[model samples]
Target chain A: MNTQVLSGKPLAALIQQRAQDEARVLENSGRHPVLAVVVATDDESTLWYVRSIERAAERLGIGCRIVDLGSEATEQVLASVLRDLSAEPSVNGIILQTPLPVGVKADSLVGLIAPEKDIDGANPLSLGRLAVGQHAFAPATAQAVVELLDHFDVPVAGRNVTVVGRSAVVGKPLALLLLERDATVTICHSKSGPLERHTQPADVVVVAAGRTGLLKGSHLSPETVVVDVGTNVLPDGSLVGDVDEASVTGVAAGLTPVPGGVGSVTTALLLLHTVEAARQQEPAQLAAAASAARI
Target chain B: MNTQVLSGKPLAALIQQRAQDEARVLENSGRHPVLAVVVATDDESTLWYVRSIERAAERLGIGCRIVDLGSEATEQVLASVLRDLSAEPSVNGIILQTPLPVGVKADSLVGLIAPEKDIDGANPLSLGRLAVGQHAFAPATAQAVVELLDHFDVPVAGRNVTVVGRSAVVGKPLALLLLERDATVTICHSKSGPLERHTQPADVVVVAAGRTGLLKGSHLSPETVVVDVGTNVLPDGSLVGDVDEASVTGVAAGLTPVPGGVGSVTTALLLLHTVEAARQQEPAQLAAAASAARI
Candidate 1:
């Protein structure tokens, strides 16, 4: 098939080691990186995801705190808790876990996180900065896709990339990131007709549509590079990606597999972002101290 | 040919009248809507644009204040003036004129304006909100394009739209706006190969590339709807658009002319946005007052 499998495990381990090294330096400076994840649901999968994140962060020498706002918590309570965490100097990163309490949308509350502490790029301001080509933390999953391509030395600039999803957290932001890198990006969604028409001509295609088996062999060109961001659970309790890997394995030049791609790298990036947030706060604290001393 | 000229004059007048009506309501409520435009250079064209805005705003019974920072004004001076204007409660809208002095990029300084007071959508936060489909003031020029299309009853939902530029003010934001209306949009720029490859299949094409005569008749399929946003100055000092009007007249079903198309409509929308900002602020101010009474 000549298809190279892009595994996130090796990259995740490499990034985790780097994050651990950085965390040690911050600890030596008497500062510890902490990520506060707010969970507002009782869903098993959501809780499982939270625990995995905690374990991953701890492995990287970063502290992960889970603030479970019980299923009955109102939006106001959640907002207040987020505000308190945002104000705490020890909290380097803040993330609101998904499956938020009923009638309470995450979008309305994510803006409360201090932008610098929004390590996951959940804040609209971060996405906005990315769109305008300014300095801001990109959402980890989107950044992971780019990191995977870069690690493999794939050329992006001046290349055609068709992203087959348009969610703000993934597809839209990813398109902007690619655009900033000087790649010609086309964002297609459910409304975009004839998926093959868009994907066939692209040098690289990113499939983030939640639907499993959305991209078949017919949708890709012989040498197309594919990144599958979908992690759909099959009826048998196993995971299948958006692309039917069996069908496209022979057609595509490079592909990121379902289990060993995107998700693992996303976790590693979150820890790295936590460490990064802690590092950025050092200078700001020093500046504040300097101003106080002058007074 | 059956070429239909989509003049902005009729639309501008209609919107201007609506703006004037709204301005009277705000004035009657003891809150006169005001727009403060900050000019930082002595370029004749820039000054001419400022005067045009001032006259348009006044015609709509909106107060216009020109804050001239002079040609020698530094970035610090420009930022300070914009901050002051933003903080003024009566100044419902704040706009920064183009041709900023050397070393002062507009993007870097526009963030100083408060989002609520940024009627011209200079702030990145507003654009970010728009990206996420949240309520935020869109850039006047971008909104004008959509407003013109809607006024003519050109359906956008499920239509294929090709936007020929990616500037934050026009092309990029317009693409996002069109996306919000359920149109499948492809944003093409200098790097995108063969303009016709993108435009020919699009039900509508919006040309915003500043290059004169960028889109000719050859670029179109029969009966394509074209919106020309270019305002390039010809060698003879006359203004033209990105499209070659003579070449496309016979081939296109609808087209917007250069000098009288987007520019005039953009001016009217700026005033309309000023009124909208004033209207939005009233409720927030009332809430603050009501809370203060309880305190």
Candidate 2:
């Protein structure tokens, strides 16, 4: 059986080019799009991820502000920072990064993010808006999965798509996105009994469980298109997905590689979302800029 | 197979009693819980439903203010009315009745009902908050389904629960509530192909499709528990649910009767939610009232 690799690089590049073009247009209009990433942790991987976002933003000509409050940041401090960022007209998007300090609850702080500036859709308002079929930026990772599926020409409408994990960032949001697309979405979590029961009958299986090798060939049918959204670091300092790549390679009709799949597209989408936010926030500014350019 | 009837009357009575007790206490303390019902249209059924709510509120000693904007109300009028009700210090709960005027979209007006006053959970923010497992009121009908299941001693944890219909008010919200209780929920809609494919294997099936007899005997396994949320009115002025009760009675393990099931509990829950919202909104007011009464 020939296995198809649903790579995210081509899609990510396409999105990145679009973001770059939009960012340049906004910049020419004297309205530079900026993404404010609020980080309260000193975790190595988290810092690495933030740096990658900065590099990506730089490449796209979008301003990336890394508001590192350090490891000892309190929830009060975090909340205040988010509130200020939300009110900051210069900041087009706001992302409260994970792995907060000991007492800082993400749920408590996420609400402080203004919905217009919520590029990653961390705000509950964004989630609710998405669920009710309203226009809101979905979580970048969740939206990336949908974008990847579209890129691969995989039809989600009327298809059985099983989403593994129930995290707010990925699974839950992804399920809402799929449901909007008219897909029969089943969300499986730790409490959900065997993974195979849900995955085997699915037309497309999305693994975002974060546990390495959580999904294998045995869990899916030969016709299943598997999307691995997990990026787990192995003991050998290598990144792998929730799916056991070797086991599901030929058995599954199609599979998305971890590092080169959802992750790449997520970063690209964040930049695009920032650009979009900028455009939405200052449409009059863009119009004025366009008129000035004509003059 | 002899099937058990899951009656919501007992649970509705319990909730009503609780709401009455709370309302009495709140009223004594100078903070009377008031639910404002904003009606826009002359839809007979919608008005009847609103009147029933008013009667229920009266019976519970909770204040029900019917703010009828009449049939010719514009979206602007509806939005302003909702905003005024939301801002009214005496108003603890707000419900915008459906079958609104021709051009008035419920979605646009629902957001105007502040989350604190959104007893019915019509606000997208409320839904979003519920989705993230945050502190928010679940839509009463959705919450009623869970409460009824609990009263009947139906365990949803780690069970296969298929929800038919994907409306924001009932099916979607109910699915989220069930998911929170650790049920592996599958939301089946019109696009989900054949309904039996999703329903027949479920440990529990909740039908909220608004289509009479949407689920029949063949749509379920013998061991399945069914909760009918539909309230379709027949041409003869008879009320029926989405489930064909006669067809499913002997086949399913348990079934909730149409009029005596989710509807009764939903009204009771709405009143309860209003009292609870009142308590939450004016803790200081209640505290002050308690002190005054003590004096």
Candidate 3:
């Protein structure tokens, strides 16, 4: 590949090391970083993700609990379960997996999570805090993007950064995070006229527009660090990204690979948040979940 | 001026016209946009601002009322007042002016205002809504930025826009608004490193950072539109903007003047929200308020 692949492994490892250090500090202080993840059903993907969290917590010496509510969980049951987790002294971070069965709206549950406990930063309150530059749980994936950029020694300060997409989950927060880093950021979405025109001038091009291969090299600067967050399954059962791999590699200087880039770092980032939440809540919570798990 | 200016005069007229159209529909439906502005011992400037709101409401055919509280207002007293206003049907929007006594926290009072009447969009919940792309009130000054941009036929879509500042009242919400309009938005604040570098590449630069002459000709592209939201008074008793006039008029394609730009549009937007809140509230509440006023 002509384009240098921006490896996330080392950056994710750095984040993991910090989490481990935090976990140790918590343990020394008789406080532990605790994360409670709720999965409503036995989807294969959810199982894998939950396992990743569980193992990461083990490796970092942090507390991670998996709560399975089953497929038929109602919103009331889910909220009640979340409330219990929120109130538990041992639980510092909470992660609710998506695809919460049919008829259960994810939007309604977003507001239900306490902003502090929202490790994934999906709560509207957390999001609002993010917008206002207040004390907030930075959305993990978006935070990871910045972390990865920093790890690569890419200077966001005074860079022209263009972000494609405005989904609350990734694009919007990512753009804000970049802005906070002093990069002049422009966010493009479906409504943005002439997407390529915006993309080509940026020093950093981050495509989280959801559509597979929506961005090509034609839209990028020569040495732009391209971060692609799209994970689309091609007809051939292959994973594709928002940036057309063939085109970007030849034209761009550095690019993040689809599967091993942002996606791989997500679970690790969650682990980091779990540890952060543990450290924050250690004074007030953590032991309660320990006892609850025992029961 | 070489720098671009987003003059608010044209934009204010446009937004007011829209607000007027909504007012007619609301009144025809037996609903009137009613605003309840409460203040504790208003300072001169504060009094002037209130008067401006009254005039704007009167001009728009929107109903307006005031709760001029004494300086010795307590949190309990204000909370009780807000609670009554929230319960009152006629009060569509609730605006609490400042000079808040030292002990009183402005944030604490937000919970007391009903979401429907939170026209100032000061409530954290409402601000959070804007962050998450949910339907909520955008702060007056921030919304005015977009309204002004749109009125001037600014091609916000796919443009690189930078907002300098992150104050809840202006910078933060303005960034969100730009993102909504499909602009690639980057936000730079005090902590933002090498912040001026980002401004040079921006198609549109919005300087809400209050420090006079914070933005200048060297920090901008000759084609950039400079919207200065700063309202500062100079030693010579002259109004000033964040951008140094000597530097900006020679660089930016367009720019907003300090006195006549963003500061002018904010009140009109507040009135618009009040009218909207009035239209949304039940008629029984306003009639009750009308009765109370008569007594």
Clashes of each: 0, 0, 25
Candidate 2 ranges beyond 4 A from true positions: A283-295, B283-295
* Candidate 1 local lDDT, A1-295, one digit each (tens): 6889989899989889989999999999898999999998998878998999999888778999999987888999999898888777778899998888789988879888888889988888887777777778899999999999888888888777888888888987887788777677777889888998789878999999999999998999898999999999887878888999988898999999989899889999999999999999875774553454354
Docking class of 2: medium
- Of the candidates shown, which would achieve the greatest DockQ relative to the real structure? 2
DockQ of 1: 0.55
- Per-candidate Cα lDDT values, in order, are 0.87, 0.90, 0.79
Interface RMSD of each: 1.6, 0.9, 3.1
Per-residue lDDT of model 3, residues A36-72, tens digit only? 8888976776687688879888898878788888999
Winner on TM-score between 1 and 3 is: 1
Rank candidates by lDDT, best first.
2, 1, 3
- Best-performing candidate as measured by TM-score: 2
Candidate 1 predicts chain B with a TM-score of 0.95
Task: Please say which candidate is ahead in DockQ: 2 or 3.
Answer: 2
What DockQ was computed for model 3? 0.39
Compared with the true structure, what per-residue lDDT tens digits does model 3 show for residues B86-162?
Answer: 77766788888887877887776875777668887887778778877777888888887787777777788777788
TM-score of each candidate's B chain against the true B chain: 0.95, 0.95, 0.90
What order do you get sorting by TM-score, best first? 2, 1, 3
